[model samples]
Target: MGEFKVLEIKQSIFEDNDKDAEAVRAELKEKGVFLLNLMSSPGSGKTTTLCRTIELLKNQLRIGIMEADIDSDVDAKTIAEQGVKSIQLHTGGMCHLDADMTRQGLKGLGIEDVDLAILENVGNLVCPAEFDTGSVKNAMILSVPEGHDKPLKYPLMFSICDVVLINKIDVMPYFDFDLEKCKEYIAMRNPNAKVIPICARTGEGMEEWAAWLKEEVNEWQTN
Candidate 1:
């Protein structure tokens, strides 16, 4: 066998992406825009939760949405109906978006007048966690059907998030999902993570989630 060079491509990619992410953050901060990177497994009700959140805070804050997916424009279209600026980002078969990609999406969404820009990241528990999207805050949705052990399974995802939303709580009785146990697991991974239980469909516990977001945006823009 011939001598081969090991380039450490993965590490290099992350290093470059991290640098780009900081630039993205600085740009948002300068514009007084709060960018949120929201992630979850597919069908976790992210869109529905976003819709409910928009309903709650749209009046007070200028909101924008960037819906990223491997394909399809469904989520972007859905968000546009809420009367907020929205753009769809196709990942071109990639599972997650890096900081440069996020920056491009932000530009397309136009953040000059936006106070809160939410990036609905491509649904997945793995790659999305590995890439920094340059958001002010990172949040993920864990629905009841996904099981409480997710935090234990995807520790990186849980540990990186500033907040975790337990969606589909209204069906907890049928799913055997333990809310307390989920929170405990999350704490094990990230002691500072805030966990919110909610049913986006019924608007249950959404007020608290929206309140948290509003406070975060206010703080990001104010300070």
Candidate 2:
């Protein structure tokens, strides 16, 4: 007779994170908060987009932001100046934010009455796409300089995004970025994603972006 040993490996790292994210979603829904998880690589105009978005929407909707960075309060300050409530989440060297950190940032905002909330995830395309931070939508920004080949290079980020902002289009003439190729890649990876181009610095294409934000926020209020 042979005795067989069966080792029990009952551990799930993402389990608790998923649970926390679900709770965060429920909390936002109950409070009528429309949360957007914004992702992008460094120097992609993500912070500028946040500031411009808040400036455009704050008058109509109560908007707040949670700015996640490797280490910096500059983005948060920029958003706050637009009269939008904002909190900076320094990742302390981490590349991205998990549900727990996002929940903590949300708690700090204390803007339950706000109609819209945007979490500016740490400027890294690879890591931010992996975790769900319980946001209503996953948004991403891709600047012209990052190259049109990015969606293929970082497929996860493109695949998970609900909306994609092709930012810094004003610099299109100076760069080798191809508009059609980027759109094609996005379509191939995530056909459902809504894509918008913008130059957040000059306020170009901002109205359309603001319009989408309004509609998203209004729908949040209703649902």
Candidate 3:
């Protein structure tokens, strides 16, 4: 066989995607929109947490949602029930949304009147963390059932997240989920990650989440 040139396709793809992500951010800034990328494993109560967040901030901010899935509109319909503007993004068989895909979703969602745009990304820990979706902030939900060692296992995911919401805290007593240990592990990976314990089912600790979002949106809009 003849000698062949090697191509680092993965690195090249990420470099191109990073450029696209920066473009997406510039466009969002021009429109005064804050795009939040929310990620988690399946059954982590992302939808439930989002619904509660909408209830808290919908009146104060013009929010829009982009529900991304491989091939389902279930989440989009669920968000529509809350009376907010929502659109479903089908990623075909892709495991995650890249910056170009996110830009397309934003265009389809119509950010003209939207102050806050949320992308409920595909439910998973691995692929999503590897791709930057051009979000102003990245947040993830970790449920009690998922255990405290998630940060140790998925260090990249935790490290990239600006905030981590520890969900299902109300059931902490039933499970062996160590909240402090989880926080410690997360801190080891990311010292600045804001960790909040919340129960989406009970509306506990949601105010702090909403307030954090509000402050982020205000900062995004003003500066």
What is the clash count of model 2? 0
For candidate 1, what is the TM-score? 0.95
Which residue ranges in model 2 land beyond 4 Å of their true spot? Answer: 1-7, 10-12
Worst 10-residue lDDT window, candidate 2: 76-85
Leading candidate by lDDT: 3
RMSD of 1: 2.6
The CA lDDT of each predicted structure is 0.96, 0.89, 0.97
Q: Estimate the overall C-alpha local distance difference test score of candidate 3.
A: 0.97
lDDT of 3 at 94: 93
The TM-score, computed over Cα atoms with residue i paired to residue i, of candidate 3 is: 0.95
Candidate order by decreasing TM-score: 3, 1, 2
Estimate, for each residue in 22-54, the C-alpha lDDT of model 2 and write its tens digit.
999998888989889999998999888888887
List model 1 lDDT by residue over 1-223, tens digit each: 9999978545675898999999999999999999999999999999999999999999999999999999999999999999999999999999999999999999998999999999999999999999999999999999999999999999999999999999999999999798899999999999999999999999999999999999999998889
Q: What would the TM-scores of all predictions be?
A: 0.95, 0.94, 0.95
Worst 10 residues of 1 by lDDT: 5-14
- Kindly list the per-residue Cα lDDT of model 3 for residues 58-170, writing each as its tens digit: 99999999999999899999999998999999999999999999999999999999999999999999999999999999999999999999999999999999999999999
RMSD per prediction, one decimal? 2.6, 2.8, 2.3
